[model samples]
Target: MKLANVQQPIRLGAMTLPNRIIMGSMHVGLEKLPNGVERLADFYAERASGGAGLIVTGGAAVLPEGGMGEVYCNVFLDEHIEQLRIITEKVHQQKGKIALQLFHAGRYAYKEVTGLDPVAPSPLQAPINRTQPRELDEAGIERTIAAFASGAVRAQKAGFDAVEIMGSEGYLINQFLSPVTNQRQDEWGGDFGRRTRFGVEVAKRVREAVGRDFPVLFRMSGLDLIPDSTTIEETLQFARMLEEAGVDALNIGIGWHESKVPTISMMVPRGAYVWVAQQVKEAVHIPVIASNRINDIRHAEEILQAGRCDLVSLARPFLADPQIVAKSVQGRFDEVNTCIACNQACLDHIFDGKVASCLVNPMVGREVEWALAQATVRKKVAVVGAGPAGLEAARVLAERGHEVVLFEKQERIGGQLNYARQVPGKAEFNETLRYYQTQLVKLGVEVRLGTEASADELVREGFAEVVIATGVVPRRPEIAGQEMPHVVMYNEVFEHKVKVASKVVIVGAGGIACDLSHLLVHDEVISPEAAEYLLAYRILDAKALHKLQTGKRKVFMLRRGKHVGTGLGKTTRWATLAYLKQNGVEMLTEIEYKRIAEEGVYITRNGEEQVIPADTVIIAAGATPNDALYHALAGRIPVHLIGGAKEAGELDAKRAILEGAQVGRAI
Candidate 1:
């Protein structure tokens, strides 16, 4: 808990950091909001005050064709320098060092957004962007190298303490490094040395523009995570080349945007890719930074102490809790709101071209508007149901100097989240519960567990306002033989109230069903120790390793819709479904449910009647809102409805917490 390793100061060129945790770059979609610059400044300022040693900003395009749209900051513009200065000044005021990331999307850039054909090292079409980019000609390549140097100068002019060349994550520079994208016989491609020239030249030009004294970092892809990409030896060679080019440090990024691997998701184990950084660290003389899914201070300290890398970079963790480093250093690690990496609000929002926020912390983008202020009038408030909604409402109200009492019928908090934590890979949900438990106590919230408040009692208590966050109940599906002993709800399986057999047939293919299938199939959790031993000993290859990870079970999910895992986040849905498929979970869409018997589930798929044999049947057909308390208390004292009591279409925790905060502030 002392965090000595992370607390140790590290130097990069002329700059010295107070700690090893860097707030990694994240495109928060805050640059395009109304009063965007000020909001962006406030966003970074809060994180800086919390205690990040260095903050690397989101990508700032060096060329007009390199940008995504109006959302991106074009450093070539004169106006952008003044706006960027505001961000640098705010972070400096908090005693934090900030770095600007010079970026070019290349083939990753969308023609729809930039209104121009994307350019790349070759004419290879990018799978993710679905765009066939125009190959950069000789003149275009010269201009690009010059543009990177100009961007670095602009960043220094804007008062940034450092400048990081964005060369990773399948960007313009990465495209030139990988053989998968680069196939030209010219000087820019056809060999490892030729391919690496573009990135090395960019780094050299940037260093020359900013001088040797100014800090310069290059974010390089340690593992492209794609087939026929850069090998480990090639990556190490690139790192050495970058050091020779006067780059101060190396930030190792894993995978690419077009990679099939799930780099940053809830399913990925914490600190999963630090080994990649360790390889780069061993190859380079300058400091190396490990990134991707390194969310906690303990993980960061361990990575540094293990000599994996010189520093750790955390992007989503800061979004989840701006004060993550501050709280951890104070020995309140349990109170830190850990990033679950659900991608529901952060990456998904970016992909959809909307302002990004956090599922756990909704006030991320709305910093100025949602800042907690003392309430004008303090009064007794009752928030029923100790789920995410009630817990958040109680915490916010108490923080605003209001007396709050929270009620829960169950003996514990986290209503549906309790079931969520039971699923493999979602154990991080327990952290959310732990954070609320600590905050509720610190804020002096009166939590009444095992005591469900009735509408009559709420009126009798003379509560100024009653929040009905009663949550939801499972909606039983209409099927024949529904009362069979083998049939049970999703929560029953999660709670171990009903035993799950080998062959399981689940009714519904929503997020819950997908998660249930995953839970049932994975009989035993794969510990990181076991995974490392298996790989380190060379006992199993990649294919065999994947087999061992997914346990032996037969799961069949039936749905009337075409797509499985509907309503899931864009960044997560595909990976979840792919993992399920790899685990042998059969998903049948556009199937009409016939009946559930002792034998199995009979369904009509493509007008063919067939019975899916199963030992257990699970009903994960979503839920209906539990709003009886709200109706009972209507017009009886001041009453309000939130969370599942208000709506239960998809059990959206993001909306629930947001509504709870808004309602708490309203009172």
Candidate 2:
């Protein structure tokens, strides 16, 4: 794999990249305290050991006003040099290259902390901030440029092998380059050429500050993913200018933070930004790095093999398994825990003010010192069902040096997860299945596909313990449309067996429901149809979609509750709401499902009856415990049920994995 070539040594300008894979910079507010630095040191050291060629530390503020935040970050002052050095030295010990992203949040920074006003090409604060920012004067602009140069020099002196300018994600440099944010009449705004000047100046100054041969990585947006901003063609021109300025590489980024279309900003597909990389690479002489929901090797390979980008940057995958490269090399990829992108684990944890961790790999931040397994002791374990829960359970147990067996009723693996993966742009979910399958094989967890491991068989076989992970069933909503031919459940739609009408209406507002609304009505970010399906959701400004429902589309999301539970992360939920509204999606909340007709759905909102127009009806109400198998064995034998079978996927994966581990620990 060209990207995987990072696992071995390669020349990266002045720095010899110990490998090809660069753990791209991700700011989780990790640059503040000694402990944060220590946590980061452990984080990088583990990846370095795991075979990362380079580790780019998260954004470090050049000036207090331009800082990403006040949390974890290395302040480029003389006082903090030693602390930053500690991180660089740790990576060096493993022959890894570590670069620090020199950043100035510019307008994104907090004015109170900077002692100076947050400055931008215009007097605009990011819409969310609602803060009235002071516009930058010519002198102030010069100072800001100097600040960036100083920050780059400080990073190089702090022992970083390279310095990457954080110009992507609608950051300062991007803010200057974008018409959406840079509404100034001066040379720094208006036309694309003028708007790009700040970024070009910043790059030139940064290179001069760091010296000609000292490898400087420029992070740039491939597409703003924002309305009324730079287009793909302009982005290509910027990439050329970036290279002409002596930039070593461009870490291509897409989208702006705090936008109505941020789903396109943060998610949609793994390596979704590869196209931006390709565009830039085609016009530039330097390397182009791509990222965006990228967590699978096969997808990464496609991007490289297709010559889309020079490198694939993985944030969550590396978080899930810093040792993913090493394990994959040994063909032990499945043994590496897979991230579900539930974002519940890492992103949610970060916003909630905790060090980042993977929902699948809880060991992400603790890699400097902790291990989940005990080498000397061992046990025999059985994991029933091969879905996310059961698969996670079996992998962890077997890795503890336990003798394990995983049973599945289907010829294929994955339980409910298989259905979930059938949705468009969700194929990456197969990564989890692949990881588990590989791990089970490598760990020698005897797999019994197309066979059910009945408790009776386990008992008769003299097995010490039995684990049951039967999963769940989707409950049909109790309504007049319950048996309607045009009505269908998300399960049926996802399974691809159910024939959807040319026009369809999806009910419910949880994760799956919203996902279906996005999918059935639009193309997934990864699909070729994405360009045509992109729809601007007026309800939730952040909820941008690509699917276009055949025929004139009308989806009625019926509700019967006081509050709609998004079941998405807080940020994503708000973003979704804003998007759905913006896209002209009909959401009838606090309404009861009364009936379904050929025309649409009949509903009652706040106790008042309302009839909504629809062509076909679908339900995302929820799931029921799929436990017929468990019920038969309950009285006959002791049976433990996990996952949806336990409580509709209600925070029970942890419970299931722990139960499997504890049961293994005891055995």
Q: Give me the candidate number with maximum lDDT.
A: 1
- Candidate 1 weakest ten by summed lDDT: 520-529
Candidate 2 per-residue lDDT, tens place, 1-667, comes to 3445444455556777654467877765444545877778878888888876677888888777777455547455666677788888888888777888888776777655456567677888787564666777788788878878888887878888999899988788998998888888887778888898899998999999889879899989887778878888888888899889988988987777766555432346555457667878889878888877776565665666677877777777788778777766676545666555666656776656565666566566666445665646565556778776677667767777777778888888877667656654456567667776777777788888999776667767654445677677787767775776777878777777687664666777777777676556553334444433332324222223223332235565666665454566755667655665655666767777777887888777777886776667787888888777677667665556766666774333434444444444433
Clashes of each: 0, 42
Expressed as tens digits, the lDDT of each residue in 1-667 for candidate 1 is 7899999998888899999999999999898888887898899999999999999999999998998686767787767788799999999999989999999999999999899999999998988877799999999999999999998999999999999999999999999999999998899999999999999999999999999899999999999999999999999999999999999999999999988989999889888899899988988889999998888899899889999999999999999999999999998898899999989999999999888999999999888889999999999999999889998999999999999999999899998888778888888888899999999999999999999789889999999999989988888878887898999998788777888888899999998898888888885556768878888999877677777767777999998989899878899899989988978999999999889899999999998999999899999898999999999999987888999888885658888888888898999
Candidate 1 runs further than 4 Å off: 525-550
lDDT of 2: 0.71
What is the lDDT for 166 in model 2? 90
Model 2 TM-score is 0.80
Per-model TM-score on C-alpha atoms:
0.97, 0.80
Look at candidate 1 and tell me the lDDT of residue 306: 90
- The per-residue C-alpha lDDT of model 2 at residue 494 equals 72
